[model samples]
Each structure stands twice: as C-alpha cells, then as structure tokens.
Target: MKKFILIVVFSFILAGIFTFINQPQAETVNRPSDKETSNLFESLQNELYEIYDIGAFKTASNPNYTINEIIIPINGSQEYYDSVKDEVESLVKNIIKTTSFKNYSVIVEKNKLDQFFNEKAKDEMDLRYEITKTVHDSLYEAYQNQIGDIGITDSAQQLIIEVNTFFNGQESNDFFKEMENKLNIIFQEKLSSNLLVKESSITIHIYNKYGERIN
Candidate 1:
C-alpha cells in the first residue's frame, strides 16, 4: 500500500512539472533596429521634402535618445507659417506613429538653414568688399589719367576722394561726384545678390523630429 502511495505521489509531481513547462512565456515588445530607424527617418524626410511650403528639414535619432530632433528652415511670412503649421504638425505625428519611437519632438527654427549656405554667404560678403575696392582703384586710375592729380582713401562707409586744388590749374568737384555715384551703384548691385543682406530678410522655422516647434 505504501509503494502504491509513493507511485501516486511521484506521478502527481511529474504532472505538475509538465504543466509548468507547457505554460506560455510572457511576450516581449520588439524594438526597431538601427537600420530600421534610419530607414524610417529617411522616409519621413523625403515626405517632408515633398511638401511645397517646407524649405528644408533635418533629422537626428538614436535608440538611447527618448526624443528625436528635426529642424526645418522656413523662409515664409507669418501668414504662411500660420497656414502650414497645423498641416506640418499632423504630417509629422503620423510619420512618427509609423515608427517604434514612443516619444519624440519636432523643432522649427525661425531662419536657420544649413551651415554650408551660411558659410557661403560670409565668403560672398568678403568677395563683395574686395570687388568694391578694386572698382574704386580702377576709377582712381582713370581719374588720374584724365582729370589730373587726386588722392583716394578708404573710410568706414565712404571712400574719400581728395583732389588737388591746383591740378592742371583747375578744381574738379564733378569728377569726385562721378566716382562716388559709380561706387555706390556697384556696391548696391553686388550686395543685393547676397542672402545675408538685411534689406531682404527670410524667416526660419525649427521643430523636433516629432514635429513640435521649440518656441
């Protein structure tokens, strides 16, 4: 009878072990791989590029980062910004939802574009200064050859053209006026083409990768 009881107890233990082994394991959430995240970012960026009103967009992402960064540069007016703000927000949110990121942000800077363009503008400004100087020198040479002795000095905003009062026994204020006008025209024409010129201003927008403005 004891042997029968022992056999029954052993069978019970084995049944319990089998039941435990057959039970389902807890499920785990699958996170996106680095390549997958990169693909998602590029896809979203391409969509953003297709938007007519958006001038430019940049994306930054990392698995360890809780929030992603996206910068969009805008050159539109306040009216334009108001019009497209909602649409941009909606589009970004939808794109983010398609990804594994649970939290993210979008940034829209007022007038910040790529660094390359900014550097180019600075280089152009320097070129403008050099070109303007050359034009002045050329004009000075022409004056000396035709009108007589003169002195040219560079000042902060104006070029001082000093004429000898006794040059060829005549004072020519007309020549100075002509030189000044010519220089002004050249400066205006060249500087107008500059993107950094304040006379023509552009607006920039900033946002996070999730499409929220940074304020």
Candidate 2:
C-alpha cells in the first residue's frame, strides 16, 4: 500500500505543471523570467479575461467549482464562495496574462468516415477517440488543479467588487466587462473559424497567495 501510494504521488508530481508540495511559503510570489514563461502568462491572461461577459464576471456566487475543490455541504458561506469566485477571476486573468494557448492547443480535423479505418479491418477510430478524450481530460484536470488550490469556496460576489475595486477601481471593471463581451465574440469566432468546434463555456477559479480560502 505504501509503495502504491508513493508511485501514485510520484506520477502526479511528474505529470503536473506545478508541484503542490513545493510552492512558496507566502504571497510575494516570484515572477517567472524565461521567455516561454512570460509568453504563457501574458497569453493566458489576455485570452481568459477578454472572453467573458460582465454579468459572467459580475459575480458567479453559485459557480461550479467541482473540477478543482471539494464541495462542502454548507452553501451560504458567502465569504468563502465570494472569495473563491474572486480568486478564480483573478487567476483567470493571471493565467491569461501568463500561459499561452499554444501550450495546450489542439487541432481537430474532421475527416471523412473512411479515413478512420484501414484495409486490415481494424477499428482504429475507437482507439483513437479514447486516446484523444484521455489526453483532453488529463490536460483539463491539470489546468483545474493548478488554479484550484487557491480558490475559496462558499463565498460571494461582493468580494469581487471589493478586490477589483481595490486593484483597478469599480469603473475599470465596467471597461473590463466590455472587453470581456467583445472577447467572447472574438474567441468564439476564432474557434469556429479555426477549430470549427463550438466552445460552450470557459470557466475559471483563482486562489490567493495563502493557499487558503481568501474570503
């Protein structure tokens, strides 16, 4: 059992973008300096923030954070929920600023049904689809876990107004909202034109420096 646990732990560590066991002790985080790191930060921030509606960002108090954190029974934990939402937005912005979609970009080509099989009569389509889903799931999970650690659950939206106000002022949030709306259209159009697939929603959650519930 111990060996099994150790192997599982090691596997996750090797697979993850950042190690949960090895983060800094406090907030004043050190920024990454390499070109790749810088580009990722900038792209992720730009892509994420510029894609949502103001209402979407306004406050998703009852947001779905199931992908990252465990949902507790107590629901009215406004501070907790609000904090989680705020952190998520903040991280979404930060991730937009940092990570590049090229890091996880996928090109899905819609081929004719005939292309899926070979002359040998082997069912290659089934195998390939499973592999694709598995890869997508893993990437989504890692993305979830990376930002999930700092999200505060059971919080409310007022927290967002507070933080955004403090950081860029309430009025700036309005401008961000406009940018978010335009971005939503642009990203959707871009996805439709390029990937030719429809993306329903792109949600995110953030965590503050403490790795605890911010609210």
Candidate 3:
C-alpha cells in the first residue's frame, strides 16, 4: 500500500512538470514609451511639413516597433483638401515604404477649422439657390425683349427662347447656328453683368420648340 501511494504521488508530479513545459508562452508586446513615441512623431512631422502645407500630427501610436496609426488633423475646405489629397497620399505611401514598420496607416481627418468652412459652404449654397432664381427671371425678360426683333414668339411660362432665325429669309442651318451663337454671347454678357448671381455658377440654355438645344 505504501509503495503504491509513493508511485501515485511521483506520477502526479511528473505530469504537472510535463504540462508546464508544453504550455504556450505569453509573447511580450514591446510598445514604445510615451516619450519615444512623441519624439518619433515629431521627427516625422518636421519632415512632412517641409514639403506639404498641412497641420501638425495630432497623435501617433507605435506598439511593438510597428507604426500602427499616425493621425494628422486637416483644417480646410473640400476644395482645398482635393488639391492636396494626391500629394498627401503620395507622402504617406513614401513614408510607409521608407520607414521600418511592420504595419501602419496614415489618417488625415478634418478638424474644427474644416467644420467652419463646411458650414460656410452650406451658407453659400443656400444663397446660390436664390441667385439662380434671379438669373432665370432676368434671362426670361431679356429673351422676351430680343425675341420680337429676332422674329420669334415664345410663351412667358416656358424657359425656352425660340429665335425665328429659321423664318428670316436665310433658312440655311448656318443662319440658325449663327443666331444661336450670337444669342449665347448676349445672354452670357447679361448674366455676367448681374450683381446677384455668380457668372461662373450659372449657364443659359436656349432651346427650340422641338426640345432641341439651339445653343
């Protein structure tokens, strides 16, 4: 009985040791210290700013010697971002290739300053709607004034301005094309002269009764 108890105890001890030896070891993630992360981010920031017109590096994360996330705060309108997006993308790609990092990504996020610009854009668009209405009304009036001399009659409710260049003895396609071209010039000049509407944002369309564009 004593020998059997000893054998049982010895077997339990051996099993425990074997189990400990076979267990998976916990891998240590060597995340960079806060100071080290800040320094590396600052260095990268200096290099980036030298070539690009952009804001500072808001935050960075480098865990286990791998640059995980490099966040950059952008403060500009959509148009401004569009102009710089390609350059920023190229810069990030170059950095990812040259830097010794296993995994990383750059984020260019819009900040408070950009939000302000976005609000401003919204305001401009609201005003633009009103300006467009003014342009349409003014163009309709101008079309009415010129249509009589040009020998055409058009409905007031309709936006189409039909010119009777087709009836003015020169029935060739050239005459109609020339008349349309001249009308376009006149309308463009009138649109440009308007104080309420932006000439760049507005376009005048001249169409015949057959739903075809004259100009």
Model 1, CA-based lDDT: 0.54
Per-candidate TM equals 0.37, 0.17, 0.34
lDDT of each prediction vs. the true structure? 0.54, 0.34, 0.55
* Candidate 1 lowest-lDDT run of ten: 200-209
> What are the per-residue Cα lDDT tens digits for candidate 2 across 22-76?
7664322233236755565445446534542111111111223212211111122
Tell me the tens digit of each residue's lDDT in model 3 across 72-158.
Answer: 666566677677776675676566564433245667765566688779778756654444454445445645443321222224322
Candidate 3 backbone overlaps, count: 0
Question: Which of 1 and 3 is the better model by TM-score?
Answer: 1
Give the number of colliding residue pairs in candidate 2: 30
Model 3: runs farther than 4 Å from truth? Answer: 1-29, 60-67, 96-102, 117-215
Which prediction has the highest TM-score against the true structure? 1
How many clashes (backbone N, Cα, C below 3 Å) per candidate?
19, 30, 0
Give residue 208's error in model 1 in angstroms.
57
Cα deviation at 177, candidate 2, in Å, is 1.0
Where in model 2 is the C-alpha error above 4 Å? 1-171, 194-199, 204-215
**Order of models, best lDDT first:** 3, 1, 2
* lDDT head-to-head 1 vs 2, winner: 1
